[model samples]
Target: MAFGTGNQIRTAGRFIRSVFLGPQLAAFLPAVMLGAYWFGGEGVLLVAAVILPALIAFAGLASRGLDLRSPRDSVTGLPGRDHLVRHLDITARATGGNDSQARVGLVIEIDNFRGLQGMYGESGAEAILRQTSERIAGVMRRDDLIASLGNGRFGIAMEKTPRVDLETMIRLSTRLQEAIAAPFSIDGARILVTACVGFALPGRVPDQTGDAYLAAAESALAEAQRSGPASIRAFTRAMRPRVSVPDALTKEVVRALEDGQIRPWFQPQISTDTGALTGFEALARWEHPEKGRIAPGAFLPAIARAGLFERLGEVILFNALTAIREWDRAGLEVPTVAVNFSPDELRNPELFDKLRWELDRFDLAPERLTIEVLEDVVAKSDDDVVTRNIAALSKLGCPIDLDDFGTGHASIANIRRFNVNRIKIDRSFVTRVDTDRDQQNMVAAILTMAERLGLATLGEGVESHGEHAMLSQLGCSHVQGYSIAKPMPFEETGAWIIENQRRICDHPRLPRQAG
Candidate 1:
């Protein structure tokens, strides 16, 4: 009870500090003074000033802190994004004036930060950010500037000195990564953090602006992120051209779709309790004639940019339905095949009609098809077409699964509004469920909420026997990831079914057949 009281007092103190120190307090002070004057005149005003002089002083500090033109981040007290950009601009101009001098700009992103925020609450995440910023600051030279780039990302501007070379910058970046990668103790839990570093040297692009350098650095950062944790990539000329090349590749994506080169690969979903095959998620894969097998990440964005998502979605849907029909004919008891619907595809008025037509054309049961919607799309989009089509699909007996459940701005309202049938706990939460207590608690909460709502739960990215067992013990209905099976071609799926049949039939706990 004493601890609870102390917590409440601390919470109240934080509220008071925020009220006094927040930017809006300055705007509200005059109204407050006026109310004071109107109610009790000079005596009350004097009393208020005497009692609240510290607040008034803090408000003055807040005004300076809240200045829009200020270069500092309010939370971390480090240089903000605009400050870093402006610093880059100044450095670029200075370097342009002196042909011998150059600058290096870097962007560092904390990978899986959204997952961290999900496991730890906002305050805990902010505490980690503060510690991260401080550690990065500790690694930098006095002249080098680091700034908060928002969203668990940071920007660094380093002016090239006579003592510093490309090797020096590389070493500095490595040091920064090492410092940040060290475990942080927050809220009594030790959490390991990893960062992706991307750096650009001005010598590489003598004619480009600071913003251009930053963009190049971001490209390198994206590549580093793709390479996974604690990775670094330096910007190169080849990366620059690849930016514009996506436009050309968009055409290739369209061609692939039309030429039947884009095909659906099935990643199996299994029941956690029974180890039976539940369903398959139809993932899109492109077989480019020239490039060979193109990953979806390489081409899906291009397809979306070309406004061909709807067409590509249709092709995937058709292929998935055809595969299900073929599996049925092959005497495989695969129950359903899930296909993702992008926001644009969901917003299409013809979505329901197209799905209904395809289901009827294949003579497949509506229950045999699952429609997956990303949580962000359902939570953030206010499209009537999407809303109506989801409802229509639900009414047509197609189960709706909320994909990437914990990573979005999803709420109870969103689940209720969309009438979600199943919630797929994102890979972020499922990755280390067996080891991480926070992850275990998060998954348990999600499962409990889903259970009370009468919705099923599937854990995506379940990779180990331990994770699968833990999820089953926690009441997750289904699991999917590489541990079960990689996404395979339609032809191979039949053989896989035959190979796994005995395990399915022999399990002590037989899973209820999924529609």
Candidate 2:
């Protein structure tokens, strides 16, 4: 009775075909028998009845077999891309006149899907794909059409309805992201797959083809993939061809690295209880000749696209270490300087050696530097190189702090695998802690977990005194954000430190302690 199995449906179809054909053949056989007159009436009737029905049944079986083999994804049972396009065309034509009704299309791609498929064999991979499809289907409305675009990509079309405004569509897309990001169990191995989602809204262009809408969505998808895992981007006219930096600018980024034009800006991390400066996180800044000062968001992608991420990291590391050494010589008592490492930089075979070389060059200890890695970076537990590098760094005595902790799906696993020494609660959670009970509870839970794990906690982006006070009460070890101090160049750090010392001494609310 269950239609879940394809074989069962095929069996039922065969039975229905036999029933239809048997009656038609029974009537035809009597006429054939009378015309042929090859035997006595009764004898001819019997022979014709059996022979005709058998022949008709054979034809029906063939037709049913073809229907069962119709174009569909063999694994997920979703329609093929061609069918999706046809459906979109129909919707476009049906709603062409209704200006209020606009069609929205989405393209969802599993990030690093091929790598997952390769790790698990064909059967296991197919199971994951089927589960992913099911999760997506669970979130869609009855009228929304979904299809397999092959190569671990799925397409969705949501026709405009009274309830489905732009905001609703965005919320739905976010739900899809969360759905796919949930952990999966395949062949006794637990795995997590993030998604890159892109959407295209109805455009103003006259008579835009279905392919154009799909093309726009794909363009946005590419942008999301470059941005990172679990990213969502919406297509716009400006994003028509693609989003990219010029090759000349990329080359200049490389030159900037070599010329020491990219420098480190230090943001102090202060103790919540003692109000003493504990450390500084070295943030990268580009001193472009024409641009004057370029933020990391502007040039970091270019550097990564140009495959110069490792070089940029090296520059940042060298500069941070040099600044720390200089600070020490200036009679400043800065305890530690944290430097960020990208996933690619962490996986480099010479990462450990490079760190050691930089430490030795600056005549500094490894403990003086904290290695900050993004939560998503540490989530790649399957990468042996990444895991090994992290272990080596930890063994070398550099504290590993998981940056942007709660934003990622793999926080607990990352902490267990990387032996993290600190967890920096992301600003999103910290910024609203004072106003939102849910935010406060979430921060409380994170601090509780860190305490149990014997790890330190730092509250980032603490722009308000309420947030700072809340974090302090919650037992956060350190705090860093606009409220404490803005990131400044090496030359300005001494003056800022002196100013902060004076202010902390003047204010009774802030407790002062020896550096």
Candidate 3:
């Protein structure tokens, strides 16, 4: 009867304490009972029930102590900004007390954080952050405090750092940069990480906030990042820009097409051997009402970012075809029209079906239309989407021209893997060919290879008579450049082609100039 009464009392006490102490203490009832039984005292149960919760609370509080003796990271197992601020304060005071040597702050940012998230997904992004934290920690000294400021950014307080000795610190930063650049395998894909580092000395810091040092470092890092990937830079006041436009410009560009602002300009392509007009390539442009004629350089990049490249392609194609038909009706011999296609256009399965329907509506021949594809798009994936699209175009008697060859990682592979009828040498190699022997040799070899493969070659950026003669001798089938004719409006191109036809028939060798 006595044992039953005691057990009942103990059970009642646990329920009351759980209600008063809440969930964290309620978990300790079993341990308290075991401790009470291990000690040979009937009265010890009452003491243990109270003592266990108190001990647990004390241990939790002790774990969170923010004093210097506490663990570098707080109870959250995350290093707090207070740790960084405390170190900076100590270093500033110590170095300020000495009037000669100065303390410098370095802030390192993980370059392309969003890119990693895009390429590797969220879990991979978090893993990269954790690994970066450990790497920064490993490079840190006992006196040099490090703390995570959130995201993939970290701050460092270099104690008693000297301005003249910044070279050694930069070398250490270089090692960190190289370590990040080294390839990492994640989720069956290889990823390369890079960082932009910024540094500051005492008086050179920004805003005088606790994060001033870190901010200065980040500012320098941003300046370094303009060149891209694994770059390091020191912050400068001159590098800060006054205005930062929002990404809403992409939305403005998307609506530009519906607003009748997006249109095409035609550039003429002439036969290299005969200097006769063969075709015109359609290039997109946006005539912004406010900005005044935004080049493809400005708005095309935004269009690409907004994932409207296919829509852009379709608009250009329809406009070009309409222009070609108008020119044909006006008694201009429209030899052929070439339209460039982005990777997105090739991957779109319905691109061909939509194209065929449009061509039929306009009564245009496939032989008179050429599709210009980038060399980079061919090597992006092994999906065979582009190859299949090219084959379908070929079946329709459409000539597939690989544009910007020798510029990307796999230009030669594109020729071997994809069935292309023409190869256009990138302007970079063509412009330098006359001056550089190696460039000339490379262009000659590519031309010879294309010849053996029975593919027509187009040499772009032929600006001089000598260049034209060299390209013709080298067996380039087509030529397009400023010397021939720049990209112009549809009506002007029609007028120019008529004059060239009259001149070519009259005096075959009379080097024709624009009328």
lDDT of each: 0.80, 0.78, 0.70
User: For candidate 2, which ten residues in a row score worst on lDDT?
Assistant: 506-515
TM-score, ranked from best to worst: 1, 2, 3
Q: Candidate 3, which ten residues in sequence have the lowest lDDT sum?
A: 506-515
Q: Model 3, which residues run further than 4 Å from truth?
A: 1-246, 409-417, 503-515
Clashing pairs in 1: none
How accurate locally is residue 258 in candidate 2, as Cα lDDT from 0 to 100? 89
* TM-score of candidate 1 against the unseen true structure: 0.59
lDDT of 3: 0.70
Sort by lDDT, best first: what order? 1, 2, 3
lDDT tens string, model 3, 1-515?
Answer: 67669779977976665455545755768876877878857678878767767766765554444543534442124465677776666556545533246556777778546545654567887777777776776776666667776557777776564442456767878977766655566776545466877776556554444456555666676566544445677666665521122477799977997776897888888886465788888988776776555546457777878899988987889889998899888888777899998888998888788888888999999877888987767656566776788778878888888887765445566676677888888765565355556556777888878878889989876656666666766667888876677677776887888877776665434242221
| TM-score top scorer | 1
lDDT of 2 by residue, 331-403 (tens): 8888899999988898898888889888888889888999998886776557888888888989999999898
Highest lDDT: give the candidate number: 1
Residue pairs with backbone atoms closer than 3 Å in model 2 (clashes): none
Using all chains and alpha carbons, the TM-scores for the candidates as numbered come to: 0.59, 0.53, 0.52
Model 1 regions more than 4 Å off = 1-245, 505-515
